[model samples]
Target: MSKSITITNEDILQEIKLSCKTPEIVEQIVSRKVIISAAKEAGIEVETEELQKAADLFRLINKLTSAEETWAWLEKHSLSLDDFEAIVYSSVIFGKLSQHLFTDKIEPYFFENQLDYAGVVMYEVVLNDEDLAIELFYAVKEGEMSFSDVAHKYIQDTELRRKGGYLGIVRRQDLKPEISAAVFAVTPPQLLKPIVTSKGLHLIFVEEIIQPELDNKLRNQILTNLFDEWIKQQIQPVEFVKLFELGS
Candidate 1:
């Protein structure tokens, strides 16, 4: 009952090549292939037991209780059972290779760049007009109105407005460069003046700052980030030939 589109011809491929995301997609594929190759060379092969466990976890997560349902799901995704198992096996190899290469560097990296992982809970009101932004900032500073009340009434985004413009807990690096310095510079319960970015002017109120600790999850995250950077560097020098872009 679901609609589907198949990319069986060169036309679909050509269209994808012209898209803005084509280069990024190609980079990801190339980096992954490099990782898989390195993993194989290092003899970090995924075992049958690991593959089966991964497939079982996949089925459980998707609520595919029956074999028939699992098959149907695979069919819907245009994937065979073997293809799914191969994908899972490759993922296991990649993870193991990443862990093996970077396990020792995680703690040192975490200590050096601890601020990047620290989370901040912020209340923000973004406006397109700078004049209105400054007015609102002054109003909040003068104690004429509450920031939350102003955000609820004047914030343009419906979802953010509903939450009184609360941006929730976010890593410092997750913020834009212009906003990141300002947000991280202040302590909690401080209001930032109008900060302009490409998106718009943002008036930010810091609610809380969650400091980063080298926990298991955080350590794993840092390792993954480092692995990703390594992968990017590994593929950065390779040039892709645009065969489709010729005379099209």
Candidate 2:
């Protein structure tokens, strides 16, 4: 025997007000309307095949493998089948409109910012002591000790130690400026002098520096970034008036 509880629309509005998320919710609503209006002006339309493809992607992303799981999800969200279709409709149309608006800019942007996309594959061992890190760096450089040996002995984290402190392919933007400058300054298969940051002394071994490629994935990413900035600019001057007072 369990007690039945029902949450009403009033409850949701009150909670949104109390949580101080009303402005955020209103912003999202206004943004969606803005995108929809833009889509209409650009004559951007969602085709049946495109909608189906987007729906499949939505399901795959949400792990809606079975009809039952999907129904449960919709029930939890208080959404109908039509609502689900509308969600993907807006999303796909916005993406298509973004490509329509910014596709030409991708190539120029990539070449101009080519250095930002450069990445490296390297291993790292962070230490608390600068002297110890310097000792280990020389040991690896002089072939008196191996990076793997230093990692195994001095690295504290079990998983990192086990992997021999291997950090997979890391982009230049992902590292701190100090680390990035030092890491990319020298050529590969080389030992970098110990660099100090807030974290600790970082003894690094640069395995390889991967050059940038303007592939379809990177192109889409660039398009999305451009669209996001453009849309934010569109949102700045627009103001919304709340129909009701919060906590009223």
Q: Estimate the TM-score of every prediction.
A: 0.81, 0.91
Residue-pair clash count for candidate 1: 0
The reply for model 2, stretches above 4 Å from the true place, is: none
lDDT tens per residue, model 1, 40-143: 78888777898888878878889999999988999998799788887788777888999988999998888889888889999988888999899999999999
lDDT per residue for candidate 2 within 1-248, as digits (tens), equals 99999987788889998999988888888888888899899998889999999999999999999899999999999999999998999989889889888999999999999887899999999999988998889889999999999999989999999999899988888899999998888889888988999999999999999999998888888898899998889898997875787556
In candidate 1, position 132 carries an lDDT of 89
Residue 67 accuracy (lDDT) in model 2: 94
In terms of TM-score, the best-performing candidate is 2
lDDT of 1 at 172: 90
